[model samples]
Target chain A: MRLRNGPAASVRYEGILRICAIGLAVFSLLSWLLLGANRGWTKTTRTRWQKDPVTEIEGPLIEKAFLPGVDLLAVGLSGALILFVVSLLVTKNKTNSNQVNSSS
Target chain B: MKNKFVAALGFIALAATAFAAPLEFDFKDPKGVNNVIFKTDAPLESINGTATGISGNVTFDPDNPGAVKGKIVVQSASLHLGNPMQKEHLHSDKWLDVTRYPEITFEVESAKNVKTEGNVTTADVGGKMSLHGATKPITVPVKMTFLKDKLKARTGKEGDLLVIRANFKIRRSDFRINPGQMEDKVSDDIELNLSIAGAAPRG
Candidate 1:
């Protein structure tokens, strides 16, 4: 049987992309919270104005960030997450147009 | 005879003042003991490091603490970031470019808003600090203690030691360090904490 580009089929495909986007967003937020909490991050928030010890993690010449328990690899994963969200957006828009055309 | 005594006293007074004037200091060996420290509080984890090879001197006055001037320099290549690759990335051409700009210098031009409390004196210090190949005028709040305080602490004879504890903040954007990366994770304002305890000239 042929996979038809019908309105119903397009909606189903778009549903998957929409769900993926939401799932990725939720994952990032949760990682930021749970991972941040895991790495000994305090409950209080810190701003730039308050003076933190110079001896703490970030030094003069280098700056590397990771979620609490996760190390540098977390940065690469975050980048991938961003790409996934962008891809989902593009695919969903394409699916929407396809549905409109088939319905018309 | 009385006139002669007064002239003799005047000569000694001049000599003492000259001796009490600012004396310069050279950086100590293995400069890692006293160095430049920087820290950033990111959402993920805090990143920190220290740059050694700290070289420079201060012309500090024990007699008149307000009259002080000097510059401290941190060798870029000597920075210890705890990771060889991370250190390399920081010193790379994109960042500090250790080859092109090998040093970050903080020149203390003068001191202002000077006030003293017992053995401790605090001042608003004016200086020009250059970082990442960019130089800017900066005034930092500093607390100073004459070496004599050390002598007092030890109940020993007062010698030539001056302690300067200066903590200040500068925006990384001010020096154009990856300024275009608006989404950078590092904090824009960088905290600089310097503790320099060494000798000075005292008449």
Candidate 2:
């Protein structure tokens, strides 16, 4: 099959970028929620550890380690989303300009 | 009347002393007790690993609610993962580049006692997390217990060992680990989990 040219290609590119942008946004939001939720879980666990004075039977192992510079990851993801959107907009604008120029 | 005043002052001082609890950690244990785990969602064949050879100090006084101080560091090159091929790939120029960036460090900002129930005290420890070459501010919920000379801590528990547990998603692109030709195979969002244990302090 022959591939579409000019406007078609641009359209496909824009669509891919838009999808990527949305995906990144959703991923970032979910990350924030998970972190917050984990914090809540930690609080509850601490309460349980203190209140329920039971035997230390090694129920389930608890993992606690810091991810150095994680905030940068969040910020960087945000930036990537922004860049993806901007590129799509710029590509669409250029496509429109080319179409107008050709028509004129 | 005079005796009552002195008794009240003494009570306050005693309460303050009872609240102070400081502990140190040694990471020489081979049971994976002191290892630090880090995760990233980048869809690369391998982007997650564990860091061992940890050595640090943590001094915390829960009673005062403001005297918490500590520093921890993990040798960056010590990070190990599932397979040998993956390990070599990670240490290569594509990811950690272990030869260049050798250590991940954390500097304590402030530790505040959020809630205390009996012997267990939960504190919100805010500080800077540095990895690769970037540093960011992060707040970790640290639950600690003072047992004689040994101190045990539980953080971010998801059916894992207690000491430190963190779950945060990161983008590999941020650290300049872009998916150039094989973008589809590798994901940009990476989820991280960390579990660490520290040794108790000595007199």
- State which candidate has the highest DockQ: 1
Model 1 chain B is weakest, by summed lDDT over 10 consecutive residues, at B149-158
Interface RMSD of each: 10.9, 13.3
Interface RMSD for candidate number 2?
A: 13.3
Instruction: Say which candidate scores most in lDDT.
Output: 1
lDDT of 2 by residue, A1-104 (tens): 12246566666767777777777766766665664523211121110111111213111223443221335346747876786877667586757767776999
lDDT of each: 0.64, 0.55
lDDT of 2 by residue, B53-87 (tens): 66666665535434557777777777765445556
Complex DockQ, candidate 1:
0.04
Could you give candidate 1's per-residue lDDT for residues B1-203 as a string of tens digits? 99999999999999998766566654442323455677766554466666657778887766676887888888888765554555677789877888999889989988999988776789999999898889999999998766553432322344455566788898878898887463245677778777655543233
lDDT score at residue B70, model 1, on the 0-100 scale? 85
Which regions of candidate 2 are displaced past 4 Å? A1-104, B1-32, B42-48, B64-66, B151-162, B179-183
RMSD of 2: 15.9
Q: How close is candidate 1 to the true structure, as a TM-score?
A: 0.60
